[model samples]
Target: MYPASYYYRRRLPGRSRGKGLIICLIVFLMFSTGIGLLKLINIQQAIPKFPLLILGQKGENALNLMCSAMPLLPVSIELNDESNNQSSIQLADILVLRLSRVFRLDRQSPIALLEKELPVPVEVESSAVPVMKAAPVLPNPPSPEPEEPRQAQVPTLSEECLMAVYNTHTGETYALTDGMDRLQGKKGGVVQAAAALEEELEKKLGIRVARSDAINDDVYQYSYAKSKAVLEKLLAENSQIVAAFDVHRDAGKSREESIVNIDGEILAPILIIVGSDARAEFPGWQNNYQFAKKLASEINKQYPGLCLGVMVKDGRYNQFLHPRALLLEIGSVSNSTEEAVQSARLLGKVLGPLIREIYENKQSE
Candidate 1:
């Protein structure tokens, strides 16, 4: 009963209908495969790993220490790449570390042990390389007067600085009334961090630290007055108090910035803040810069990416009283108090050494 045309179409077994169906399937499969390959390539192009630029000797020093501890972080260290340019890293299993921060090996620890192990480029060629007999020998420049041996200077903490936490800001007294067990952050306060950083430094570095009144981040007028008062008191009391810090939290969303935690510990990401108050005389940043640079240099060495850069500002966050003060703005209010505390703890670890180095370097000079 089938039509004669249908019989004609089905010319041979596995020849007419079966062959057409097979051809159609092959075309469809090929199209799908092509699309999938393109999609995979696009995804690969989208998620390129971030390039870490470790600049300045301070930053480079910190990375050296970090690499010694954890060798798995994927970074392209451009210390001695032949290009001497911003080299592109091959996204391979190998870690990339770029040493833009130059270190005078003679100044820091031993060159043999540290330098030998690292991939850092060090110029060890002697300046006294013998010239050819035909070349004129330049006489050694007139010898300068011999320098005096210097002693390291230790910073003396002032009594006023010790009592800074006792002052009040917005009706809330700034004091570590309760030790670590009871210190907590108010809705818009950073007393706990100040207290914790101070306490640990005191115990670890044998240096005295004090906390200033908590000031609002938005209101400049009121905040400046309170900040100025604390600075004056510290400077008036302790000439050795080379640094003062104002710690604040940011107001950004949690997703925009977040603190990482491992088990019971919180991971901290500190942001350095510089003010922009143009009205004041002696923005006090130079002194602030000295302290900040010293701290940033040392901490960045101890903990890679832990101590962020020093922010330059035109305003006085009470930094005018002394050049050695800093304003630390940690992650925003959206983050939990625990995150801030975690950051404070990590900060303390490197802060002690940083302070020590600053004082030591000053004395050596």
Candidate 2:
């Protein structure tokens, strides 16, 4: 014979146990949702101060792109007006596109036409309103100056900039893809990333950066000495150059381990190396450390997890030459070239304004 409590439990059929589990699950879900919301809000920043470049890579399928950008779709935020589109993208009304089969319209293509008897021409009463003549067209106003004058001003604006970028380990390469081959020693894949950084700084950020394609590391051990010489020459040539970035790549990681994601886009993690005087005569190492920390913080503020962190090394990795010099590991050997290239653009986005601020301060002094 069973007890009365056992008979009561059998009658309910898990009703009491199910309710407790359901409540706990609901609480867990709510906590998870709250944390996710906080993370999204914390990642948002006011990027209106800089020229906004298209961060997405092309050639990606539409489905993945849509899914990646869905979380960042505008909920309550500010965007540029079409008339004042200083950045690359021009704001416009969103259009929903769908896949469907449609009739082809083209020239020089032969197709059988369906013949139909014409009915007649019917005149409409409101055909020509003639209201446009009453006032000048508000859209597309005449420019005060021609396109030539405006185009010429861009070079003049960026020519005054003093910045330098070069590759210490020019032989460093990354994972390859279709139609993209690896570079031989001397001009490796990392050089393209350095070139991209130089271009982004000049074109997007309006900062002219001198880049050297010299074969620095013909031999592995003397790479630092060769890079130091190159950096010295750059400093000598550009007297006003305040900052120098020596681009390199990290190693000893798998392809999947090397790449990091920020806002759904794949990126190569940036590691800032600040060398100290433990092995060499590096004075004012604290300055470089502080700068690196600030830069890492700024990059994380904009795209969290893209920057690994600032590292202090024992040997002087040619950073002893300049107070603002830094050695940047754009990615590891396992990352793709495209990932490094995109990361270079992101680095320029944060680094340009920081360097520009220092330049302005020096000028004011």
Candidate 2: regions farther than 4 A off = 1-158, 177-184
lDDT of 1 at 2: 70
Candidate 1, overall lDDT?
0.50
Residue 34's lDDT in candidate 1: 25
lDDT of 1 by residue, 72-133 (tens): 32132323243522222222101111111222223222333234444544544575576567
lDDT of 1 at 352: 64
Q: In lDDT terms, how accurate is model 2?
A: 0.68
Where does model 1 exceed 4 Å of error?
1-189, 213-221, 260-265, 276-279, 361-365
What's the residue-level lDDT of 323 in candidate 2?
89
lDDT of 1 at 239: 58
Top model number, TM-score? 2
Model 2 agreement with the true structure over 1-365: per-residue lDDT tens digits: 77999988887788768766755653443232322322222222212211234213232332232224443322211232333332212111101000011122221111100001112122335756544556655788667874553333234233554888998878887755322233446587789889989887888777888789898877878888899899999998888787899998887877677889887898899999999999878879999899999999999999899999999989888888888899999988777888899999999899888878888888889
CA lDDT scores, all candidates in order: 0.50, 0.68
